[model samples]
Structures are given as structure tokens and as C-alpha cells.
Target: MSRKLDPRVVRTRQMLRDALVELIHEQGYEKITVQDITSRATLNRATFYLHYRDKLDLLYQSSKEIVKDLTECIDLSFEEDKEFDFLSDKPHIVFIRLFEQVSQNSNLYKVFLTEKNMPHFTSRIKDVLVDFILKGINHVQPDDQLLTVPREIAVRYFAAAFLEVIVWWLEKDMPYAPKYMAGLLMRIAIKGPYVNNPF
Candidate 1:
């Protein structure tokens, strides 16, 4: 069984996370000291240490939380046998929601994604996406250049594509809104036959 977190503990951690997000936007992660975070959070060094091992550890915690929330919003079961278009809509909507949250503090996310810590965040997202795709499309076997790729391969491809798109968006100062991006990315990722299958 899992233990429930204390309300006070949860609140304190969120405060620290909020502070860290704010601080990262103003300066590089390498340049932002622990003292800066503690000061911004209005908490002491001991309190910061109690919640996280260090700055890097806090970043991991933030990434883990985002991934967990994202995975939860996804429904793994599809007993109704959804149409491909139906499947496309789900990702577009879900990703838009995540993107909206990211847009709240774009600069913070920009710093996080481009920094050395990217691999940690990228890997966590890839693992979740892999598990989601592998379970949903377990038997996707194409017979052309769109070959019979394994579920793991599909996940990796999806994750890689999304990461590239996201990095570009961040670098571009996020010229488009989340809804526009959701639609555009859906077009790129909606899987289908290599040959025309407009049935």
C-alpha cells in the first residue's frame, strides 16, 4: 500500500517548486544558486534540504511530477476499437493541455529543456510515451517503408518527434498557440499506411 503525503508537506514542496520555476526563468540553471531558491521561496536552507537533496534533485522531482500527471490523463484501455482519427484527437487534446501548462512559464521550460538536464526529462517522457503506445498499438505491422515497427520503436519515434517539435517551439519564442500546434503535430503523427488508404 502507498502512504499518503501530509498536506503541509505537499504545500511546502509546491511552494519550493513554484519558487524554483520562477528562479530558473531569470537565469541559467547553472548560475541559479540554492540560496537564490531558498530566498525566493521565503524558506530556510534546512527546509529546502528537507524537501529536496539539491537543485538538480528538485528538477528531477519536477519532471517526474509532470510526467506522472501526463500519463494519468491518458486512458490506456481502448475496448471500443477507436478509429485512427479518433486516436489522433485524443493525443491532440491531451498534448494541448500539457502545452498550456508549459506555456504558463515558458521561459522556465525553455531553460530546462535546453540545459544538460534535458536527457533526464526527455527519457522520462519517452518511457511514458513508449508504455502508452506499446500497450495501445501492440500489433501495428505495416508492409512497406512504413515497416512493421515494434511498439518500442513507435514510442521512441513519437517521443523523438515531439521533443524536436517542442525544442523548436521553445527556441522560436512559441510563435503559435497550443491549439494550432496540437492540430499541426497531430497531422505529422497520425499513423497510416505508406500507400494511399483513403477508405
Candidate 2:
């Protein structure tokens, strides 16, 4: 009750993702079509639809694939056997790896980081960050009810803040070094909001 795709299937999917990425760089995501992607990728229209529903699906899959790879490469879940301040270091280290990924392939990440019209990535980012926040919170406060309104405010704001900061960093014409920016990001994220809120 299983299936393994042929090697060609793997290569074809990669081709589509790569082609779509190139096309996105040349033109905005809104302007891209399935036909355009397939043509550039040297595959047929049927092949394109068989693999991806549309340009947006291709884009989402590509971003997920890239981030999953980055996540796997980094050891974010180190054991805290000693007082090494890994909590403080976590986001900064992740930021370094994330932005280093961007630096290596800026064009690809630009498409991944902020393609405003695409809602798929919006959900993906929220899901990833929410999970991250829950993990950190559970580790620190295992008995707390995370679903409460007060808790949601902090988790939601924290994730949104991190994403906005990252997007701003990426969109900058002169990119900051990811390691330094990561440290700065982690500091604020761990510290929570600066101004008071009556929530």
C-alpha cells in the first residue's frame, strides 16, 4: 500500500520548481501561468498540472521544500544539559542559517519570503511560527492553557513581529548580516513586547 515515484518524476518536479523560480524573478507571481512554467521547464502542460495545480502551488511547495531543507541542516533542537544559554541563542542561530540561505539564493527567497498575493505561504508561515511559539511556551510553562485569549495575543504578536522583522531584513537593499540580525531578533522575541498593552 505504497508508491515510489520514478526518478524522472523527481527530476521533472525539480525542473518545474526551478523554472517557476526563474520566471518569478523575471516577472511577478501574478503574471506567471502554468503554461509559462512548463514551457520554460521543457515539460508539457499535462505534466505541469499533474505535478502542481498552478504557479501558486509550485511556489508554496518550493518554499516549503527550501525551508524544510534549511531546518534539517541546522541543529535547532540541541539538548540543554548545561547553562549554555541556548534559549537566547536559538533564534539568532536559526536566523543566521535562514539568511545565509537567502544570501546564497536571494532571488529564490524573495519569492519565498514575500509574494503578497499568495495566501498559501501566509498560512505556512503562521503555522510554522505558531508551532515554534507553542514549543517554547510548553517547555517554559508546561501547565499553562495556551488557547486562552491572553496567551494568543503574545504568541500571535510574537510570530507576526518575527515575520515582519525578517521580511524587512530581506527586503532591504543592503542586507544585514543574518547572524547579527538574528541576535537582535531573538533578543526582542525572547523579551516580548516593549510597550504596555491592556489585553
TM-score of 2: 0.68
lDDT for 147 in candidate 1 is 49
lDDT of 2 by residue, 100-183 (tens): 665665656666667666666656766676666665555555555643456667778877876777667767843677677767
Which ranges of candidate 2 are over 4 A from the true structure?
1-11, 42-50, 53-57, 67-75, 78-82, 86-95, 98-106, 140-149, 191-199
Clashes of each: 0, 0
What tens-digit string does per-residue lDDT give for candidate 1 at 1-199? 9899999999888888878877776775777778998999899999999989999888889878877776776543544444545445444445566566557657656766777746777677667766755554543332335546655576678777776787788889999997777666665666443335677
Question: Which segments of candidate 1 are over 4 A away from where they belong?
Answer: 1-4, 78-108, 139-154, 191-199
> RMSD for each model, in Å, please?
4.6, 5.1
Superpose all Cα atoms of candidate 1 onto the true structure and report the RMSD in Å to 1 decimal.
4.6
Per lDDT, the best of the predicted structures is 1
